[model samples]
Target: MFIRFLKENRYVSLLLTFLRLYLGWQWLHAGWGKISDGTFDASGFLNGAVKNMSGEHPSVQPWWGYFLKEVALPYVDLFNVLVPWGEFFVGLGLILGVFTSFSILMGLTMNFAYMFSGTTSTNPQMVLIGIFILIAGVNAGKIGLDHWFIPFFRRMLFKNTEKEFPQNI
Candidate 1:
């Protein structure tokens, strides 16, 4: 049964793996560039974007701007710090296939946030990527550290769970 599953899914797996690797590399490269550019103050950019959202010619201005100004700005600086790091880490995790489920979740969250920010152009692309990641479960791809680490992770986390282990085990 295990062998059959692997054999049948080989091509599908390869395709999804390729997509995952490509997306992961893209995200990682972008995030790495942002992190390395010390002059790129995320806080300033976020604040400026927020302010622009309130402007008449704003690129993206959702009704949430009011709430963002009132509630979000209070912690905007903190968000600035965490968001970039989150992007960097999530990209790294995806690329390495480590904590893949968590990484996908984070990517989805980020993509959704961007989508709803009144930016329709970016939303569609990000939404499609998020859907692909969710559907592919590309975390099970070949050439990933996850293949080596997931077993250890499962053992540590599900030590007492016999039924939950992979069927082949």
Candidate 2:
């Protein structure tokens, strides 16, 4: 019942619009800050996460730490580029409601990655809001660009369906 309300309610969609804007701004700010400074580095952060895996409680899991030390660290340059741009684009998408679901998923992915790296910060809060936005789905973007994009894309996708697929089949 609650899920249906979240997914279908018009009032809820308005509320979701607010949430999307907030999350979008948060992400955009963070990414823009990093991009503007031009000094954002993942090595120090990655090393810190790896170190956290050593303690008794282990804030970061061993597997995650290994991946960080091996995969992420070695490709820090790629991350250096990907992180800011990815965040920026995700934020832009959410803000514009261009691809709300994809934006939320990307945001959630980053949130979880941060949490796994032992940084609590606002990732949890963002994740919670993101999950709500995700659940709301198309309704979350109905007040934004998805209002037109969805229908447009739908027409484009199915416009030639009848001709493409044989009726006999």
Candidate 3:
């Protein structure tokens, strides 16, 4: 009953839309700062993460840290592009409610990544909000592009004659 209310109610959908916008704006601002700075470097962040890679209470997992140190730091340039642009795109998608579930998933991934790197700031709160939005599913995106595009996507992909698309799945 509680889950149904969250996923099927109009009022709840509206609330989620607002929450999506708020989270989107936060992401957009953070990404924009990096992009507009023209000299934003991810090396410092990566280095700091690598430093805390291993211990009894390490920030990052051991094996993952090895991958990060060996693969990521060696190619910091890619991340320099990926992080800022990734944040911007994720924010835009969430704000527009286009591919909302995917956007939220990406947002959650970034939140986890940040937390793993020992950057607590607002990541925990963001993760909670993201999970709620994720659970809300299509209703969370009903007011935006998902309403239109998802059906289009369904028609294009599924070619179902009996029903539009199964939102539950």
Candidate 4:
């Protein structure tokens, strides 16, 4: 039974692994460029260039500017420092297959927040990515470090018996 299930679902796992690696590389490359530049000061460029647009009005400011300003801006400097690093780490984790579930969850959460902000054309893309991550069950370790580390971590952190992998329908 287990062998049959694995055989049937093997393609799904492979697809997810490839998807994760591609998405991870895309994010990592973008974040790495930003990190290398070592400057988050887009205030003038953004306010000047993107503050006015026909379709969305403000394309430079991320979708969640209001939240970043009204809510998150109090610590805007801190956010500037953390956000790039967070993106890099998320990308790295996804590519390496380490903490794959958490990495996907974090990306999904961030993308959802952006989608809710009602500011960018990228919202649709973000939604699509989220759907892909969910459908792929990207957390189900396949050719990644999570296959080994997750079990050890689970055993160390939780006292409950390990759960069995669900059969593919």
Q: Among these predicted structures, which one has the highest TM-score?
A: 2
TM-score of 4: 0.69
Q: What TM-score fits each model?
A: 0.72, 0.94, 0.92, 0.69
lDDT by residue for model 1 (1-169), tens: 6434542465755665665666677667766776788544544544554665755677556565655566567877666666667778877887787766577678778766655454455546655765655654533444477677767866887897775766332
Which ranges of candidate 1 are over 4 A from the true structure? Answer: 1-8, 42-63, 120-123, 138-142, 161-169
What is the Cα-based TM-score of model 1? 0.72
Rank by lDDT (best first) = 2, 3, 1, 4
Candidate lDDT (C-alpha), each: 0.63, 0.90, 0.89, 0.61
If ranked by TM-score, best first, what sequence of candidates would result? 2, 3, 1, 4
lDDT of 2 at 87: 88
- For residues 12-67, what per-residue lDDT tens digits would candidate 4 score against the true structure? 66766777787678667766877888986534422333333225554434545554
Instruction: Please identify which of the two predictions, 1 or 4, would achieve the higher TM-score against the true structure.
Output: 1
Q: Write the per-residue lDDT of candidate 3 for residues 33-63, one digit (tens) a residue.
A: 9999989888888888888877789878777
Candidate 3 CA-lDDT value: 0.89
| Tens-place lDDT digits, model 2, residues 1-169 | 8878988899999999999999999988889988999999988999999999997799999999999998999999999988998889889999999889999999999999999999999999999999999988888999999889877777777797774432111
